[model samples]
Target: MQPLVVLISTFTLIFVASYASLQPAETYWNSVLPNTPMPKTIQDRLMSGSVHDWGVSKIHPDICAFYIFFPLCIGSNIKAKDDPRRYIFLTESDLKLGTKKNLYLMKSSNNANFLPQKVDDLDASTSKNLTVAINLLLSHPTSAEAKDMRNTIDMCEAGEDNACATTLEAMLDFTTSRLGNNIDTLISEGDTEVKIQSYSISDLKIMKSKKSIVCHKLTYPYAVYKCHSMSDTRAYKVSMVNANGKKINVGVVCHIDTSRWSPKHLAFEVLNVKPGTIPVCHLVPGDSIAWVPNEL
Candidate 1:
């Protein structure tokens, strides 16, 4: 009986080893290989950074505990209110009701001076549709402009992840945009070092009118307080994973007015994140508060 058991175990071991040995190197490596290289146009924009002179020099530490993200005011060209650049952040409605000629995606800058002093340029002429625009960006990534953008993003990535204002912004832009744009392909980009996972707002109840949401502003003031909660809010969950695979779950709420917008739901104000458990942002009691979109 003992000899029979030993023979059976030996056979099992041999079978396992044989199967593994027969596996093709490409097939084995493919499981761990990064997603196919992204097109250049999209890569360029993803690497792009905006020069943020407003609050680049400094940041607060207390707010680093919460996972809240405030809506940022952004435009292609900073036109005066009389010319208001049409809008700040791009929305789906803009695609149907407007065009990308005047739209500019918002990004943050972090200069190692503990401030962000440079901006990365983007060529918006890639495509008209958002999905196609992303694909086109992925396709053509070989120009000097693309190089410059990569330089900026790479600099920040190498810098302190949370300390540099631009690095933080760069992280936010890449995470949010990619997560929002394409989840499966989001983490496939080889350049970024952070790992992430997300939960959509489809089944989650993320909005409330009477509640006062909490957050920490990023710029000079680094305002920490409870923000006014609007009646209409669209949000989802994002898990910023670390090298060890631990997740920091964050509750992000966006103020999107779809009633009178270009797309069914256009996000003028991108999001108001709750400081649930993000390493960068923290929640604290406060006397000062502001409406993020209004601030934008």
Candidate 2:
């Protein structure tokens, strides 16, 4: 009887080892292959850091076009009231609506900057920060919300999109909130209440003198964004007035340098101008954020 048990255990061990060996070397991490195939147009925009739409179809068509060709429209002196292009940007209400509908897709824009890292590969400081941020947002590190966020992030990192489909809001909120907290911490210490400033698209005004971080709301199953500071860029506060007359303040950023951008880029095509000839700008959708110095 003892010999039979030993033989069975040996066979189980061999089977497990063989199965693991057959898997890809990157099986241990989310998004094992970083260089996945993407559309040339998207790839070009990403490379130039001038992407307007991160494949989010939920946004309005007119608004999307405006974002794609903002450089042309803004330069043309087109008045928001006279211009046929209705700038109907998303609002807080729209964000909460249908939160459960598109989550099944579980697709990300696949931006390299927002990709999840393997737990083991994350530095000690980063891991600690993530844990602290999650706790801050969810109130308890071991709470159900925190657990869900951690799982969603892990799944997204592991390229298990299908498995991450259900908790789209949690994933989106966690990333944005964590980033917001980081922004607050960056600006001041000791639990400073971060006051985010917003502007509207209808009344676009640029702050040329101030440096700021623009967080653009990305199109995904849920809210996600690619926020960063751009050199040679200007920030604007655009007043976004929806059809219902509800006002939302939005952030807009214009890139001043396009000398190295691809000539075939959409901005050049839309504006009928050559690359490096003009500045390109786009609005920061609702639920997104931007950080500027408090003095401004």
lDDT of 2 by residue, 1-296 (tens): 00000111232232233212232223321232233222232222221111122221122211222223243332356544343222222222222222211000111232322212221122222222446445333445675545534533443333211112112222223333333322210111011121122222355344643355544333222223334444676565544433344444445556677798877555454345676766665444323344543232
Task: Please state the error at residue 258 of candidate 1 in Å.
Answer: 2.1
TM-score of each: 0.22, 0.33
lDDT of 2 at 270: 39
Model 1 Cα lDDT, one tens digit per residue, 1-296: 00000111222232233212333323322343234233232223222222232232233232111212222122123223322112223222222211222221112221121111112111211112323322233344454333433332333233221212222233223333322322221111121232122212122222223222222222222121112223344333223333344333323333443343322111322322222211121112111111112110
Quote the positional error of residue 295 for candidate 1 in Å. Answer: 28
lDDT of 1: 0.25
Question: Cα deviation in Å at residue 33, candidate 2?
Answer: 38
Model 1 worst lDDT window (10 residues): 1-10
